[model samples]
Target: MTTTPRIAIIGAGPAGLLCARVLQLRGIEVTVYDADTAVDSRDPGGTLDLHADSGQIALEDAGLLAAFSELARPEGQAKSRLDQHGTVLSSFVPEEGDLAAPEIDRGQLRIMLDQHVRPATVRWGHKLLSATSLGGGQHRVEFANGHSATVDLLIGADGAWSRVRPLLSEAVPQYSGVSFLDVRFDEVDRRHPGIAALVGDGHVFANDGDGRAIIAQRNSEGRVRGYLGLRTELDWAASAGVDLADTASVRRYLLAEYAGWAPELLPLITDSDGEYVNRPIHTLPAPLTWRHRPGVTLIGDAAHLMSPFGGFGANLAMLDGAELARAIAEEPSTDAAITRYESVMLPRSGELAVQANQAIARFFAPGQAPAPDHEAEHRRYQEGAAAYRR
Candidate 1:
């Protein structure tokens, strides 16, 4: 008989929650840890697209895919692209009833995953501080909330700045010279019809083709969220004397920079409402790997962080969690299971990281020329699925 290991998952994000759910489904006991004081204590962020093969497969493993369909927005998968002059360059609409990929609010996903797990399985409000190794493939983890636990298997599903990452790898996330200024609009259809029409029902992209772009997407509740992307230094905002909190000042600065763009698209910048956030992209070096270690491993962003340009971060994280749980359930030993999980996880994430690096460079290359297909990742998934069927 295989050993039953004590599993402790740090981070109650989608990855951790899914991992715990799968393990429980397989009759394996697991616990999850998170810092959130309550389930909805914080903003659950915006919408996310879950690819069929990755995110969907993980949900299927956890037996939640059927319910997900009831809440998902398949129509939100459509997307359009525009040039600086706001010309409709290209667009994509998934065929009717295409389950290939669907959009869902991040909050909804969190609640769904959280509800399926065993009640009290996740110890909320326990902020992880550090993890220390105990001999024989065990680790003792300390949390900021005056709590601690020792587990036979420690899984870190925490995001980019993972506290558990240092124990496994020394890599650090580096700035990618790509940044986005948060732009949001509430009641888009009523308060901002022009932006609403441009956004349509899905996502819209407009690039100056010279290292500046505006990407907007329609979310639930008549809200729209987007990013004003620029290939600029991390300090560009401060250097330009732009206080990101001041929307008018940010709009003034962006308007000057995008002088020749279509007048109709200007509102995406000037009319945004809500908090302005300057987010600079960062990534752990690609092909990020570590020496085989027993008792502990990582999944999701903690294991391999890549630029969001590749559109694989969230999907991959969910897949990692599900796959890892299955490996552990099927393998004879904890050490053997961890080895099996990392072998595939490391290579896949590495390949996407490399692609993301290239895509980021190509997307912002200094020219008014057409850029790489924004739908490249989606197309690749379709092609891969087709190839698998043959």
Candidate 2:
């Protein structure tokens, strides 16, 4: 007789939540532990696109694709690349009925996924403190809230700094020498007309070819979010006298750094509405892997964290969750399930992680021509997306 293992998943992000949902549908007992005090504890920042094969497949597996299609903005797939002077170097507007990779606000996607999972499936606010082996292929999971449980299988979907990763792999994410100063503009068409036009439908990219760039995306509401990216030290903001709390100072610093940039692009930096958030980019060394352990495994960023350049992170994470759930459901034994899951996930994510890191460096290459071939670059991304869909 096959014994079902007691499963604990550490995270409530899309990956963890979807994994739980899939497992539950198969009548498997799985609990997701997350640090968030509640579902709305934090703003799930930015937007994401789900490739048809990876992320979309995962949603299909969980029976959330129909719901997601209702919430997703298919028109938000429009994207453009511009020079420092706000010249549209290249643009892509999807043909009608194109659903290759529809864009969705991260928050909305979370809400959709959250709706499908069982109530109490996620133990919200239960921050993982540690996971200790109890021998006999059993483990104890302790939470910061003083709660504990023993499980026969544990999956770490806890993201970049996963507390559960130390039990399986020694690799930690390292700085990628780039920092993004996150800023937002609200009611864009009404409050910032020029910036709205500059951004257009989907996404806008303004790169100076010297490691300074602006990446902005339009969200569901009238809100637009962006990041002023720079190739600098991890402590660039703190060491360079840029106070995140002081919006005025932050804007001045960015303006000065981008002094020669076109006047039309000024609103992207000047018309900020709130405190600027400093995000230092980090990634695990590419092609990372771990020897299979008995009862512990990782998924998503916990397994392979990479820059967002390749736009593969979210889709890959969802794919990992879906595939892992299927592996567990079909395999004769838990160990066999895990082995099958990692065999596919590790290699797939590792390849994409390495590609993402390379893409970052190439996007922000130094001494780039003033008018880079954005059309070619956009085509490459489209091709890559198509391949990923397969």
Candidate 3:
């Protein structure tokens, strides 16, 4: 467009922050609104491997790639496949200088992006309440903090339960019947040598095709994150009379489900250093696309939420933000830019979403045949998108 537009991004996540940063670099002014009261108002989760193509490219665009590289752990590319008995079935140890995809804490990446953005770029604690269209490619957003703004373009970088998405599509995230209880071990090499040995440099995923699995990922500073996956209903904990708020109760329930698992691996359930969080996997329909509503669009999970089995969520979200920002800076109109962004983003995220569905089914299928080699199949899944190599 010939005239500069008032752009508002609703979210402070990878998609929103990266979009705002790239927009500023392109000489476009934008504002990001988030519900967070402060930066540290979160308990950081585990580390994730960002790919060369999608995530790295976005960080490069924002000029934070070198800094990200400094904080990244390249050796974290090493991964292993194991059985319930804790036998290391197979492993992939990254070669020297192999920087295909390196791991970093999710909190670190978010903080880096937050720090690089211009001051006052993000309006924190502004929980989005609703978006009312002004017609003709414009919208007025209302926040729960008694704030409001009308902008030429409104971008929904918000996550799975985005309020902005109601204007575009009727799709809601559906439960995938897989739930994860997140556990962590801290001061590990010293306090928890056994768990550290099992995790090694990267990840150890143990599955015996019995509809349950454990994924252990090595984080920086001798910390480890484990996801105890169970193929059960969303309300399984409640139905089993396990009060999640009670740590001992949660442990008892999980340990019972894993009765036959290797005694050595049981530490993942009982010996965690702290809190146990239950995250139920959910996804929007694959190939989720809207009818090109003018002046408004979505990015990241708000646009194409999928199962996290293939490590696509954060990577896709960053790519979406970067590409959408570029489109807005180049296209002639808000509608045109949105159209351009959705055209490419939809098909790509859709493909990955389908692959994620297959992965979940293969692992969670009842008495299904043993899934293929873990790292090798993961490489196949990342072939065109997030694939990494030396």
Candidate 4:
């Protein structure tokens, strides 16, 4: 612990980037490797709300909160809950200038995080293959294309199928019995007016009161992303003759399942502006932990992956990055730092994972009850509506 340690982070994701950025600011040298060919190799995913206590704090620690605010959409916090018939059950509109949990497109957030890190800090296309412990608190990292690096510390931020995880735990990601068809529309205000009106200012969550669900969120620049969710086997689409590559066929297949829903919600699937892609939800087992090993650790989805049902995935990842970086920068010994990081992070993430898994199950549960606090929320909404009317 007397000498400076060479840290290697396997992933250029939000967690990995923020971790490396914080370390750099503290005069620590770190290298980040990612499988991505470039920053914009593909759409990073959907819109995400950076919670104040977690993701926002991470940006503040990394000196990027001001920059984040410039790109964030505060109005995107507007949320509406709906039933299968597309009737708004309740709505929550944020006060003007509320920043408690503003939303940003995932791609834009990634780009903002990327801009803050030092140039060449991330080596793209360095797809991780394996990590071998060299003993005496050292390890070697191997990449897919014959690249390798030996470092004093290795951090796994590589996500669900992390190559760096096996060195720390025997756990692997498991499918959560739900899948989604990701669809998006561009120039939504002009091209899809009805859908835009349905989505309103921010996001919409419409449940069938059974197992099916739809989540659509408004991203920056009038782009809206929608997920058509179903609880089914991993291969259900393939076996059900849903050909993802054929737009018309995919639309027909999805519409068949949603036949009884409101006509207003049909465009979310039929009017998708791009090709539909399938995403099977996956997560690590809840209440997971591993004995600490010197010179190795994990953060984000690499550690405690869970269902997006709880909407805590990205927030937890960024929080993990910021807290772990702080521990390393302050603790006197590497062992002490890892211990401190795990002590707080493990229990916290494990509990959230359990809650997230439960939320996912409840979302798919037959005839599930409204959220426990829905009655209170409904009253608040009624009061707000009356105030607006007055």
Query: Model 4 off-target regions past 4 Å?
Result: 371-390
Highest-scoring model, TM-score: 3
Predictions in order: lDDT: 0.87, 0.86, 0.87, 0.87
Error of 3 at 170 (Å): 0.4
Q: lDDT tens digits, residues 268-301, model 1? A: 8888788678889899999899998888899999
Q: Which stretches of model 2 miss by more than 4 angstroms?
A: 369-390
The RMSD (Cα, Å) of candidate 2 is 2.5
What is the TM-score of each predicted model, taking all chains together? 0.94, 0.94, 0.95, 0.94
Tell me the deviation in Å of residue 201 in model 2.
1.6
The residue-by-residue lDDT of candidate 4 on 267-311, one tens digit each, is 998888889999999989998999999999999999999999756
Native-vs-model 4 lDDT?
0.87
Name the lDDT value of residue 380 in candidate 4: 44
Instruction: Give per-residue CA lDDT, model 3, range 1-390, as digits (tens).
Output: 567999999999988999999999999999999999866688768997888768888888888889999899998988888888877777788767767689999888899899989999999999999998999989999999899999999999999999999989999999999999999999989999989998888988887678899999999888999999999999998899999999999998888899899987888888999888999999999977778888899999998888877788898899899999999999888888999999999999999888887788787776544544545544543574444322
Taking the candidates one at a time, how many backbone clashes does each contain?
A: 0, 0, 0, 0
The ten-residue window of minimal lDDT in model 2 covers 369-378
Instruction: Give candidate 3 regions above 4 Å deviation.
Output: 367-390
Best by lDDT: 3
lDDT of 2 by residue, 1-390 (tens): 078899999998989988998998888989899999887789788999887758888888898888998878877878888878877877788778877678899998887788788988889999999999787667899998999999999999999999989988899999998889888889999998887887777889889888899999988888899999999888776788988788888888899899899998877888877678888999999999999888888888899999998578998998899889988899987788989999999988999899899888887888553333434544555576567556
